[model samples]
Structures are given as structure tokens and as C-alpha cells.
Target: MGDDASLTARKAQLRKECLAARDGVGPLRRAMAGTRLYARLMGLRGRTIAGYLPIGSEANPTHAMRVLARDNRICVPVVTARGAPLRFREWWPDCPLEKGAFGVPVPTEGGWRVPDVLILPMVGFDAGGGRLGYGGGYYDRTLAGMGDALAVGFALEAQRVEAIPQERTDITLPYIITDAGVFGADGTV
Candidate 1:
């Protein structure tokens, strides 16, 4: 009981610290990071992508999502319920969007789709591709069901942490795209 309580407390503390670090980053820098992210992913084609709309200090992946939509299908995650895995809804440039859970925008009405790749926005990430999200466990649950899909985290280098305190249900992303560069299973690319 004591160990479980301590771990939960530690994860909560880390989440607060990570959010602070992300919030501390300047808006211009954050936009620049998004630009770089777009450049890295612009070459992707033909694969269905599950991207996200940035909320608060989350590193934005919309730039890449827009470009990829030219040759690929782009979708955004929808929070259907508290513990349910997120559902992906098709999205495109100028797609009708209404604020969903937590004020994150979602398609007003679109067909649901599963993605071949997931570009996850993170509050903090370690070199090992350990992601610290907003503690909702949405991505974790989503990833669990999509084990074959490649999960790539997106964040600014400022959100980099030495390590992320994790639980058994936590998922480790094998690839992370940062403002600096991409972190892969072997090393930064």
C-alpha cells in the first residue's frame, strides 16, 4: 500500500514539474519548434496519421498534420469517455471543428479511423522515448490496442527530462521528434 501510494505521489509531482517546464517555453520558440516538426514530417506520404491539436503548452503538431493531409489521411483523437481509448476522427484543412473534452478541438462530424502512425504531443520526454503526458492515460490506452502502430512523440527540447516516472500501464514511444532532433531507439538521428 505504501509503495503504491509513493509511486502515485511521485508521478503527480513529475507531471506538475513537466507541465511547468513546457509552459515556461516562449511562444515564438514553440512555434519555431512546430515549424521544424513540420519539415521533418513533410516527406511522409500515403500513411494514415493520427495527429493532435495542441492544448495549452503542448508542442503543436498541426503544421505537420496539415501538410501530411495533402497526400495522406490525417485524423485527431477524440476523448469519448473517461477511461475509454480515444477515437480518431478524420480531419483536414478547414475541417469543421468544435471544442471537445478539455477544450481541444475535434471534427464537428467525421468518420472514425485508425492510424498507421500516431504523433503524440507530450508534456515531457526522456531520451529513451518515455513520455509524460497530461496524466489522462488516453494515449497509453490507445497505444495498448494499437501495438503495431508506430508511436512517435512530439515535444520541444525544453521539455526533455532525464527520466519519466512510469507505471506498468505506461507506454514507451520508440521515436520522439524534438526541436533539436529526432530521438530513436538507437540514438538521436
Candidate 2:
């Protein structure tokens, strides 16, 4: 197999393992972890924040979104097309939501904005800030274009792996928040 093909196969295998681990988390543990994740994000400073609604076994940031929305603008990602970068739309707790691409909930209205901070969901990550997403490349493309937005990933501590297969198009996240603690891109926690 070629380099790209090999990397793709490796990623698929890792993704499966990581997702299973996340899915195996009990409901009570997941809830506690979500609370901790929200507490960690409270210290960050950002006027406009983008957060994702939990899908399946992903960690939910709804608690943080509620707190941030009280004093800051909150937005959620909307997948415009199959291969297009995500569009950020203003969202609040009670905003009308409709299922978007991949069955993820997105805001119904169309007031878009650029977020100063973006909280992303991840399947797995490494100490070096390499993130394993759902292989959609949406976050990578969005981060590449966002310039200076603080990209923070949300995941459970069990999702951490020794390393992730990297591609030229991949974008490294500066910070990843987990139930245990926050990990930095430079391998600091």
C-alpha cells in the first residue's frame, strides 16, 4: 500500500478501538466527566465560543455552553456539504435545532460568525496534540482557515493514545481537555 493508504488503514483501526473504549464508559461516569470538562473550560477566556453537541459516546459540553452563553456568544458547527468545511452558526440552549450531516444537531437559523474559541470532539489524541477525528477532515480544514482561533478538543482520558498517524493535511490542536486534566500541544499537562 502507498503511504496515504497505509496511514488510512492505521487510522481506521485506531478509530475503532478508541470509539469502543468511549462507548464502553458507563452513563454515570460519562456524566461526571462532562461536569469536569465543563469546569476546566470555565477558566479559558473567549468572547465567542464554538462547541459541539455530543453525538453517541462523545463527551457533552452542554454545561459549559450554558455558562458561556450567559456572558459570551455561543455557536455550533453546521456541515454545509459532504466535503465542505463546517460553518459556525449562532446557537443557544433553546435554539431550534435540526439534524445536519452525520445526524449531528445544528442550529436551525443561519446567522453565522467566527468563534474566538472552538471546542472540538475527538476520537483519539496523542501527547503531541495530534487528533484523530471521524476522518471527515472538516475540523482540519476549518482550523487551517481559522488562523488564530483557540482550538480545544474534548475527549475522555481513556481516548489518549501513544501516537496518531499524521498526514500532511492534519492540523494539530493547541489544547485537549479531558476528564483527568488539560494537555498542551507541547506535551505539557
Candidate 3:
């Protein structure tokens, strides 16, 4: 098979594995415990962070939410329009969030804000630190101007691969939190 075909098959298989793994929150907890992510994230000051609510088998952010809310200004992604960058809305554990377009939750009452730290979810990621979102380019465009924002992708060890298809517009994660450990762009474990 060609590269595209192989990638499609690999993604489908990995998606299934990830979903199963996320179904039980125990792994997420253990992963977070094994890594120094909590300490690192908790250290951020004056940071406006954006974290997405995990859907399907995507990297679960259930645990990260509590730490983030206590440490920094936490925001969530709200889908506004197709082909447009994502608009962020302030989010808290008890905050009322309505299911917006594309079935993702959006804050019911608040204006938008740009993120200083972006915590992204991935279906599959490569050892090269490339990301495969839910086939959306929203994060890529949103991070274009916010170069100062720290980009972090959360995923499972099973989702890590040798490489994934990437476009010129694709943005990479500087840090990745996983069940195994926190990895940098150089594939350091």
C-alpha cells in the first residue's frame, strides 16, 4: 500500500486502541502520576491555557483539568466556523458548558480569549513529534500568531509511531504528556 493508505489503516487501528484505553480512566491517572507533568504545568504563572474535552479515544484530559484550574487560567476550545481558527472560552469544572457545533462543549456565558498554553489531544502521533488531530486544522491556524504560547499534546504510548503525514501548515507540539512519560520534540522519553 501507499503511504496514505498505510497511514489511514494505522490511524484506524490506533484510534480503536486509544478509545479502549481511554474508556478506563485508570491509565490516564497512572500516566499522569508517572510523569512530572503536573509539577511542570502547575509551575506556569500568568498562563492562559486551552485544553480540550477528550472525546472518543483521544488523550484524556480529565485529570489535567483539576490541576490546570488550580494553577492557571483554563480555557476550552469552542468550534465556531469551518475553516476558521478555534475561539477559546473560559472553562472551569463547574462552569456551564453547552454542546456547541461539532458536539464539543463551549462556555455558555463568556467572551473569547487567545490561549497562552495549548493542551491538545491527538488520535495518533509520531516519534518525530508530528500530530494528527481529528482531521481539523483549527489548532494549526490558531497557533500561527500565538508563537509565544507553549504547545503541549497529550496522548497514550500506543499512539506514538515512527511518523505521520504532515502538511506545511501543521503545528508541532513542544511537549507531549503520556502514560509512559513526557516527551520533547526530539522524541526524548
Candidate 4:
């Protein structure tokens, strides 16, 4: 197999393992973890932050977005097309949402906004902030477009791996927030 094939297989294995671990978490525990993540995220300073709605067993950040929206602008990514960077639109707790690509909820009506911070969902992450995502490359493309935005990953503690296979196009997150605590790109809490 070539490098691309090997990387694809590795990502597939990690995604399955991490997703199972996340799904095993009970509802109460998941809620508690969300609270912890929210607290840690509140420390970051950004006038406009982009977040995502929870899908499946993904860790939810809606709580934090709600609180942040009170004093700051909040936005969510809209999957406009395949093989393209996502477009972000202003979003609030009660903003109307419609199903977008991949059934992800996006704001029904809002102007385009660039965020100073972006909270991305992760399947797995390593000590060096290498992230294993769903392999769509959306976040990576989006980050590449926004050179100044802070890239943060929100995940459960169980999703941490020793290392992740990375390609040249991959973007590493500088910060990761979990139920346990906030971790730096080097994996130090």
C-alpha cells in the first residue's frame, strides 16, 4: 500500500475505536464532561468563535456556545460542498437551523462571519496535537484558509492516542479540551 492508503487505513481504525469509546460513555457522564469542557473553553478570549452542533456520540459544546453568545458572536460551519473549505455563519442558541450536508445542522439564515477561534470535533488526537477526523478534510481546509484563527479540539479523555499518522495537508490543533482538563498541543494539561 502507498502512503495515502496506509494513512487512510490508520484513520479508519482510529475512528472506529475512538467512536466506540465515546459511545460507551453514559448520558450522565457525557453531560458532566460537556460541563467541564465548557468551563475550560470559557477561558479562551475570542470575539467570534465557531462551534459545531453535536452529532451522534460527539461531545457537545452547545452549552458553552450559548453562554459565549451572550457576550460574543458565535458561528457554525456550513458544509457547502465536497472537497472545499466550510463556510461559517452566525449562530445563536435559538437561531433557526436546517439540515445541511451530512445531516449536520446549520443556521437557517445568517451572514458570513470569520471566527477568531474554531472548536473542531475530533475522533482521536495525539500528544503533538495531530487530530484524526472523519477524513473529509473539511476542518483542515478551513484552517488553512483562516491563518490566524486558533484551532481547538473538543473531545473525551478516552480519545487521546499515543500518536496519529499525519499528512502534509493535515493541520494540528494547538489546544484540546476534555472532561479531565485543558491540554496543550504537546499533551500537557
Candidate 5:
């Protein structure tokens, strides 16, 4: 296999393993994780932040989004087109939503806005801030275009791996707030 192909295969295997681990977290643990994440995220205030609706076993950021909305502008990602950077639409706790691209819930009616902070879901990650997302590369493309937007990975601690296979397009996360604790850019709590 060529270098790129080999890397792709390695990442595919790791992604599968990491996702299983995330799913294995029982409801008790998942709830605990959600609580921890809500506490960790409370530190970010008065900023336009993008928080995603949880799909499957992805950690939910609804708690933080709700509280933050009182003081900050909250938005959610909308996949307007395939292979295009995601767009942010204004969101609220009770915003009318319809399943958008990929069956992810998106606001039905809201103006577009740029967020200063994006809370991204991670399929896997490494201590060096390497982020391994689902193969689509949406967050990578979005982050690249989002100048100065702080990217934070939201996941269970089970999602952390020894290393994440790197590609040129992979963007490093400044913070990964998992169930265990908040990890800094260097992967240290």
C-alpha cells in the first residue's frame, strides 16, 4: 500500500476500536461524563459557540448550550453541502429542528453566524491534540476556514487512544474535555 493508503487503513481500524469503546460506556458512566463535560464547558462564556446535537453514543453538549445561551450566542452546525465546510445556524434549547444532512438534527429556521468556539465530537484522539473524526473530514475543513475559532473536542475518556494517525489536513484541538478531565493542547490535564 502507498503511504497514504496505509495511513488510511490504520486510522480506519483505530476509529472502529475507539467508537466501540465509547459505546461501551454504560448509562451511568455516560451520565457522569455528561455532568463532567457540562462543568468543564461552563468556563467558556460570552462567546458565540457551536455545540452539536448528540447522535448515537456521542457525548451530548445540550446542558452547556442551554446555560450558555443565557449569556452567549449558541449555534449548531448545519451541513449545507457535501464536501463543504459546515455552516453555523443560531440554536436554542427549544429550536424547531429537522433532520438535515447525515440525519443530524439542525435548526429549521435560524440566521447563519460564525462561532468563536466550536465543540466538536471526537471519534478518537491522542495526547498531542491529534483529532480523529469520522472519515468525512467535515470538522477538519470547517476548522481550517474558521480563523481563530477555538476547537474543543467533546468525548468520553474512552475515546482517547495512544496515537491518532496524522494527515496533513488533520487539525489539532486546543482542548479536549472528556469525562475524566479537561485535556489541554498538549494532552495534559
Candidate 6:
């Protein structure tokens, strides 16, 4: 085979691997475990927390009922309007939820507020804190203005890239938590 053909084959193989890894249920469970551990380590008790609904390799804490059961205020993002910014609404475990844009679960009606901590999902991330999302830019755009809020991205250890594909608008996560551990300014504590 030619060089181009070999490179193309390699790219295809990587895409297949990523899809398989992202689709597996085991990775989600592991990542969720990592997220819960970090939440406690970060002293997240009683703080307002926001988490996105995971679609792929992104960690999904939705199953961790304990986090919601705790005394913290929980918020989730809802796609209110196209070409508009994301709006986060306060949510509770028992609160009624409806499917918003892209089929992501969200609160139907409420006021928006900034969260003390934001647990984000990513398709890929790196040690330098770079994150590649699902291309919607919702989390990135939403967290951009949150200077005082802790921005954390959750992922499986497998999703860690050597480095993320850089772009002008890409925001760095202050904390990147994987099943193995957490990284960034907090230094894995």
C-alpha cells in the first residue's frame, strides 16, 4: 500500500477505536467513579454544582444518585434557543425533567445561575488542560465567563490525549479528572 493509503487506514483504525471505547458502558462507570471521588476531594459538599448530560466518552454522573442526594444545589444545562448561549437551571433528583434540544435532559422552566463547580464532559482532553468537546461548544461557551467557578472536565483515562487540537476559542479546564486521577492547578489532590 502507498503512504497515503497507510495513513488513511491508521486514521480509520483510530476512529473505530475511539467509537468503541466511548460507546462501552464500562468506561462510563469508571469515569463516573473518578468524578465522584474528585467531587469529595475537592470539598464539593453543599456547593452548587453543574454537570452536563454525557453523550459519549464523557463521564456521566447522572447515575450517581448520592451526589444529588447530598445537600448541594444541582444545576443542568438546557438548550434554550438556537444560536444563543446555554442556560443552566436549578435541578433536583425528584424535579420533573424534560428532553431539551439534542435530547439532553433539562429543566423545563426556571431562572439561571452560575455554579460553584462545573463538571463537564469532553470527547478528548490533555494534561495541559485542553479539551475537545462534541463540537457544540456549549460547555466551553457556557463556562467561559465563570472566572470564580471551578471548571472541571471528566473523562476516562483512555480519553487523555498527548495534547488537544488547539483552536482560538478553546478553553482550558482548571481540573481534568480521570479514573486514574486528577490533574491541573490543584495538582491531583
What TM-score does candidate 4 get on C-alpha atoms? 0.94
lDDT of 4: 0.87
lDDT by candidate, in order shown: 0.86, 0.88, 0.74, 0.87, 0.88, 0.68
Candidate 2 lDDT tens digits, 116-173? 8999999999998999999999999999899888899888888889999999999999
lDDT of 3 by residue, 9-116 (tens): 766676665556556556546466335456557778667888887666566575677677876788888878898888899888878877887777678976677888
Q: Write the per-residue lDDT of candidate 5 for residues 93-119, one digit (tens) a residue.
A: 899999998889999988898999899
TM-score of each: 0.93, 0.94, 0.82, 0.94, 0.95, 0.77
lDDT preference between candidates 1 and 5, better one: 5
Candidate 5, run of 10 with poorest lDDT: 28-37
How do the residues 1-189 of candidate 4 rate in per-residue lDDT, one tens digit apiece? 598898888889989998898888777766776787678667765589999998998988898899888778899999988999999999998999999999899999889999988999988888778899998999999999998888889888788888898899999888888777778887788
**Candidate 6: which stretches are off by over 4 Å?**
1-17, 25-42, 63-65, 185-189
Task: Note each model's CA RMSD in angstroms.
Answer: 1.5, 1.6, 3.1, 1.5, 1.3, 5.1
Angstrom error of the Cα, residue 189, model 4: value is 0.3
- The top-ranked prediction according to TM-score is 5
Which segments of model 3 are wrong by more than 4 Å?
A: 1-36
Tens digit of per-residue lDDT, candidate 1, span 53-113: 8888788888778888999999999999999999999999889999999999999977999
Of 1 and 3, the candidate ranking higher by lDDT: 1
